[model samples]
Target: MRAADEQDYLDFATARVGALYRSASLLTTGDPHLAEDLVQETLGRMYVHWRHVSVADNPAAYAHTVLVRVFLSHRRRRSSAEQPTGALPEGVATEEDATLRLTLLDALARLGPRDRAVLVLRYWEDRSVEETARALRSSAGAVRTQSSRALGRLRSILGDSLPDLTRS
Candidate 1:
């Protein structure tokens, strides 16, 4: 690649890495290590296609789509099973905030992969139904249906605990 192209790719990656990590973390249900790996894989894939992607109308959206696809692909692999842990590692949050975060992540982790993807893309990333459909290769109707079901599942998972958990 030319120097200018390389510079553009570097600048784009630098600007977007944090957002990518945030999305990945949510998709992975707060697993930082897996989130980092997903981000790295997404960035590497983006770098390979920089010439095509850099000039897209919405490169950040493309990056997010790539991250989600990478995450789903990883989950589909045979070796992707996650082992359970009895305790969470230390995090940089107040006790109450940590509890809330853990509660939410636990609920998210229990969701099916496509349901989780719909929630993250629709709610967390704030994408339109059309946009999410395009990213996930589903029809807009499917996206809407999945999103509604996913939110209902999340509500069921949180149940009455949500009110108590959020009390500050």
Candidate 2:
């Protein structure tokens, strides 16, 4: 274990798993198993590229990118399976804060992958519009348009139940 061979990779994983799972949970609402799978896949990709990433940078952000790519590619390869209520774990199983969390997750799932990524990075990851644009490799103008349109779509999906998104 030389200094350059920094096992800080391991340190980062252990410290960040909770947040990563939370993000994955948001990304894959009804499927805890698939959420774990996506997080694992993202971790693996991150491990392979860890040399280029740094202790100072947000590894979670990089992992978010991997999750978005994996999620989008998975959708392209196979139609999303529809599991009935009986098949999915009860939303009641989620701890306190389930309501808004689940609502946001539903809104996120409704968005197209890139738009979803923008919102997730912007809100969950606490990135600025400029940082988000850089992360998504998009121009600031396009990012604003996409994020605005995405929230608008969420407003439509949730209507009176979620009018607050519309106010933005």
For TM-score, the strongest prediction is 1
Q: Candidate 2, which segments miss by more than 4 Å at Cα?
A: 1-6, 79-99, 162-168
What TM-score, over all chains together, does every model reach?
0.90, 0.73
Error of 2 at 63 (Å): 2.8
What does candidate 1's lDDT look like per residue over 1-168, in tens digits?
Answer: 889999999999999999998898888888778789999999999999999999899999999999999988888883756545444534588887788888988998899878899999999999999999999999999999999999999999999766554575
RMSD in angstroms between candidate 1 and the native structure over all alpha carbons: 2.4
Pairs clashing within candidate 2: none
lDDT string, candidate 2, 1-168, tens digits: 345545787877777777877776655655678767887887787777787765537666777767767765665676655332223434465453566656666766667767777777787778889987877778889989998998899888877664366587
Worst 10 residues of 2 by lDDT: 82-91
Worst 10 residues of 1 by lDDT: 82-91
Q: lDDT of each structure?
A: 0.88, 0.70
